[model samples]
Target: MDKVFLVAVGIGILSRIIMLNTDQRQYPAQPNILLSQLVLAFVASSLGALLVPALRDRAYTSITFLSLAAEQFRQVRENRRDSLQNLEDIQLVKRGEAFIEEIARTYEIRNYMCIITSLSTIGLYYLIIEELKIAKNTSLMISSIIGLALTLILKKLLKRESIGDIADVEIVKISFVDECIMKVGDLKGITNIGLKSDRERYLSRGIGIEIIPKDKDYTNAGILFDSGQRQTIVYNLYSRLGLYREHDEPAFVPLPRRNPKKESLIIAFIPMEKDEQKIIEAVKSCPVLASAKGKNLSLENYKIGKKGSV
Candidate 1:
């Protein structure tokens, strides 16, 4: 029983710690924040692994501790939201409030997921070796390996979905209007742009893109170009292609504006470093939210997009 708890908790904590830096999901990488998360992961995993054994010994009172942990985990979501909301003020391509809430909620659920994973693996190990009367050492090694493999597999299968899965991305052209905004391609409002110098920079390096949503099972068309998803496209694009921006006069903004009448999306961004294929690749790599991923486009109303479809 002692060895089972130790190995299970140990493996669980180790799994979480290994993923701490890598599992940021666009969050900032502050050491203190990471440390706090690690501490939380440890507690959650410990409680989960311990609960099984504690029950065998008839320690029913230990279950109460879970209620306390649940409260703490709820606070984690609140803290994360407050932190990101504070940062949202300064970001040029901001993650909107909806996106922040979703991310925080995801983080909270992730901690619980770790707890469940640890508990399941260790509990199964206990059942095999002790309850089922398997060889102790052999069960230990085999169960540990299976636990680790399952952990990895779970992580792999639950990865974030990317934009390419739900939408079609393509290179397109839409010229700037008034040097401040492009109102072309059936765009509703002014496509806010920059000064002449800005145009020069954009002319030299910018790549125009068009995003089209495919039709099959869409409930709402607007989700295809939601503000949060647009922000995601901008984030991924900037990370890969970089950009030049001023307070109001910037080089690139990867916002996908709806051409409702024409039924298309237009994106005009000036890469800090000019590369057409890379920009296309970056757009493809944008993370698609669960809220946006499952819904399909309406097939009857729209045609599959083509070159300059708008």
Candidate 2:
């Protein structure tokens, strides 16, 4: 039993530790935050690893601590929300409330996934060793592999699509009318208001992109018009290609809007460098928002009457 417990705890700790150092979204979690998450993962895994022993020993009283962990995870979500909201005030591009909410829930759930993966590993080990009478060492090795595989599978299953996955992205030129109106892609023209220096800086080095949804019903699953998606796109671009620093001027910042006339989304921004392809790559790599993911629109979805959708 001691050997088995040690194996379970080891597997659990290693699995959850992955979350402490990695996040694809580039959420900018500080060092302190990363440390906090590492501690959280340890506690979660410890609880999950000890579950079988607690049950076998009739130490049911300790099981109630899982609920306390649940409450703590909930607080983690709230803390993430607060941290993001504070950052929103300072960020040149805001991540919007919806995106912030999505991120908060994600952090909370990831910890839960670590716990689940640990429990699965421990439970499978017992099933092999105790139920099937497998050798302990063999069971330990097989269970460890299966446990890590389960964590990866759960992570992949939980991921949503990227901007490049569902949309056609085109890097285009930022056009201007009378040096003040900005025409980005095929969308409606925007009026740029910047000082002479800022305008010169933006036009000479800026990048533009046109985002077209592949299908008509993409508003729900791949909505980029929301402030969060737009901010993410710009943040990616700025991080990759560098950003033009004219914060006060509207034209200096990346702006995205829905082209009501053509039903497309367009974004225009000034990068510190003038690499169009890099800009395209950055926008394409931006993560799709959970709320934005929607079912594709099709003839079957709407009433195909003599007219159109009713």
Candidate 3:
């Protein structure tokens, strides 16, 4: 796609240079020179039109990438902001994505209009020049400038919609051990965690685990296992099945087993409001606790290995 655009632009430039030289050589004698210049300008403008859609697509792709990167950074820094502020950031990014998509669609329309308008206008100007035999260099130059100025104005108008402000979200620090523990779940295996603002009706849940060795010092050993049964549980609770947002990707990390000696896992949860009924339902569904018959130990006791073996 990019190569094709470059080739078109090169051809347009070459045509314009040829037309310019010819016009200068035949100046003040041939009115056809004005028509030729208009044709070259129209060709150049049509070629330039391809850039609009390409730039719009590029901007949309960039925003999606940056938003995910910001989410990952927020996790690494352990930054925690108020629930409302976090919600606002999510909403803002959603709006920004939609705006970018709209801009791309509009550019598609504008590309079509530019091709048609340039061809039609050039044809009209050519007829006028040939019939009137007028040396209208001033008029042609003014029209060309006006057309380019309008394109620049439209580009600026879209720029405003594309630029968005990122809201500050809080981060909470936890030790590697704590990160692992929070990731562990009951026999039925469920780990509840996500942004505080996302727990509107139910807490987002996943299978949790912990990273080991901690070589990079980038993040604690906290990891959430999101697969099979646990992933479906999250989908049902959040009502966002299949449509995962970019911000959601950073909520979990991969914790592949690095060593056999480490027996403990640590996990952390961002405190948030959760639906009691959903929590109860999820707890009831856990396999380890499901058949305990009111004999389950406290979460702290379970974490410290004080309870009987599973």
Best by TM-score: 2
Q: For residue 161, what is the lDDT in candidate 1?
A: 62
TM-score of each: 0.81, 0.86, 0.25
**In model 3, where do residues sit more than 4 Å from their true spots?**
1-107, 116-134, 166-310
lDDT of 2: 0.71
* Candidate 2 residue-wise lDDT, 1-310, digit = tens: 6666666666666655655444644465667877787788778877888887788778999779889989999999999999888987677666678768877987888778767877887788888988899998899788888988887787678766777875677887666677677777666466565567665665677667777766544353236666667676666666667666646655566767776654457777776677777766777777787765453445434421224664
Residue 35 displacement in candidate 1 (angstroms) = 3.0
Give the Cα-based TM-score of candidate 3 against the true structure: 0.25
Candidate 3 C-alpha lDDT tens digits along 148-261: 444445444433210001111112123222222222332112233344543321225332223221221111111112122222223222331122234555444222222223
Which runs of model 2 end up more than 4 angstroms from their true locations? 17-25, 215-222, 260-262, 295-310
- For each candidate, the alpha-carbon lDDT, in order, equals 0.69, 0.71, 0.32
Q: How are the candidates ranked when ordered by TM-score, highest leading? A: 2, 1, 3
Record all residue pairs in model 2 with backbone atoms less than 3 Å apart, i.e. clashing. 220-292, 220-293, 220-294, 221-292, 221-293, 221-294, 222-292, 242-272
Candidate 3 lowest-lDDT run of ten: 161-170
lDDT at position 227, candidate 2: 61
After superposition on all C-alphas, the RMSD of every candidate to the true structure, in Å, is 4.3, 3.3, 23.5
